[model samples]
Target: MNAALALHGLSFNYGDRTVLRLDALTLQPAETCAVIGPSGCGKTTLLHLVAGLLRPTLGTVSVCGQRLDELSVSACDRFRGRNMGIVFQRLHLLPALSVLENLLLAQHLARVSRDGAAANALLDALGIGELARARPAQLSQGQSQRVAIARALVHRPSLLLADEPTSSLDDGNAVRAIELLRTQAQSIGAALLVVTHDRRIRGQLDREVVLGGAA
Candidate 1:
């Protein structure tokens, strides 16, 4: 079977400055890995590259056997929607929509059929079923984080990317959040790649990739 994610000679630069460089990286389906590094070490940049939000300045990123560099803009968006799920550091939930609507929107954007049952099931699994109709502004930080995670997995993506997933939680919640991510990703058979500076979660993952300080 093809690797869930593969990066070969990946390097990203901004003008004259180099931000990230990785000779090779790979993650098999249902495997879990963490990218741990300092503030400017391109942890988030790596996530974006894999998600196809930003193209690498050099080399290639392949997700689910398809090279991101080979896909057109529209095709890339579609592929990302169907094959990848991202829990951004900022938790970009729509304030105007209810929690359930946010998940439905993800499906709509991905061109997948809207399945309210699946959406609610994911919310319930995350232990936030009752909050499904609540607006983003009404939830606590931890609640909002869970909502964001639910949104990402609503479509059962093949690759799950999370950035700083536990940056705001206390020790207890941090552990719980990481466990939720791992359990959910495994259930969907997605490869889990987390970009985090939090050392608390390092031991929970299968392996860790430490990036050097910003170049």
Candidate 2:
């Protein structure tokens, strides 16, 4: 089978300054790994590259056997929605929409058929079924974080990318959040790549990739 994610000689630049570079990286389906590094080491940049949000200045990125560099802008967006899910550091839930609507919106944007049953099932699995009708502004920090995670996984993406997923949680909630991500990703058979600085989570993953310098 094709690797869930692969990068070769990948490098990204911000104008003349190089921000991130990786000679090679690969993650198999259903595998989990953490990308850890100091500030400005391109941790988040790597996630964006894999998610097709930014193009690499050099080399190639392939997700589920398809080359991201080869896809057009529209194709890339569609591909990302169907194959990848991202939990950004800032949870970008639409405050005006209810929790269930946010997940449905994700499906709508991905061009997938809207399935409210699947959406509600996912919410129930995350232990936030009752909160499905609540708006984002009404949820607590932990509740909001769970909603963001459910939104990412509602589509059953093949590759799951999470940035600083546990950054703001306490010890208890941090562990719970990581477990949720792992369980949900495994259920969907997606390779999981988490970009985080939290030392508390390093031991929980299958392996850890430590990045050094900004190219």
Candidate 3:
């Protein structure tokens, strides 16, 4: 199967420091993959490259068969807005927006027509339907994470990238988070890439890519 995400001869640097170097990496369609490494291993950096938030110093990032490097900055942003879903550790929900409205904003930013029903359905699927009208400040940590996940999937993106998604939760919540991420990705037929150093999540994914120095 063609790769849902691919990095060829990827290398990234910041001035004098080289943060990441991958000869090749690819994630199959609907695959759940984890990128594991210690701090500074470029786990998050790799996601940034894939999402077009950062340009690779010396390689190409291919997503859904298109070369992201070939697109202009604005074009790349549009492509990501339309096809990618990113869940940050911070959950970045606008505190003032209700759960449902937060998701609507994602659709608007993507320039896609609003689909309130689809947004609500996603919230229901993520087990956050009851919190639809709740403000972000009113949610528990787990609920906040669920809202972030629902927001990411609200548009039914083709690829989902999550950074340290379960790092803040207790072991039990962490496990639930991983399962939710995996199950939801499968249901949506989207490739999932989670970057974290937490070994608790290792067993939940279909494949793993270990970054950083080898022993």
- Best of the candidates, TM-score: 3
Q: What's the distance in Å from true for residue 106, model 3?
A: 0.7
Question: Which window of 10 residues has the lowest lDDT sum in candidate 3?
Answer: 206-215
Best by lDDT: 1
* lDDT of candidate 2 over 91-196, digit per residue (tens): 9999999999999999988778899999999999999999989999999989998999999988888899999999889999999999999988998899999998
lDDT of 2 at 146: 91
lDDT of 3: 0.91
| Model 2 lowest lDDT segment of ten | 206-215
Candidate 3 residue runs with Cα over 4 Å from true position: none
lDDT by candidate, in order shown: 0.92, 0.91, 0.91
lDDT agreement of model 1 with the native: 0.92
The TM-scores of all predictions, comma-separated, are: 0.95, 0.95, 0.96
What are the RMSDs of all candidates, in order?
A: 1.7, 1.9, 1.3
Candidate 1 lDDT, 1-215, residue by residue in tens = 99999999999999989899989999999999989988888998899899998999999999989999999999998899999999988999999999999999999987789999999999999999999999999999889989999999998899999999999899999999899999999999999999998888878988789997521
Against the correct fold, how does model 2 do in TM-score? 0.95
Query: Which is the better candidate, 1 or 3, if ranked by lDDT?
Result: 1
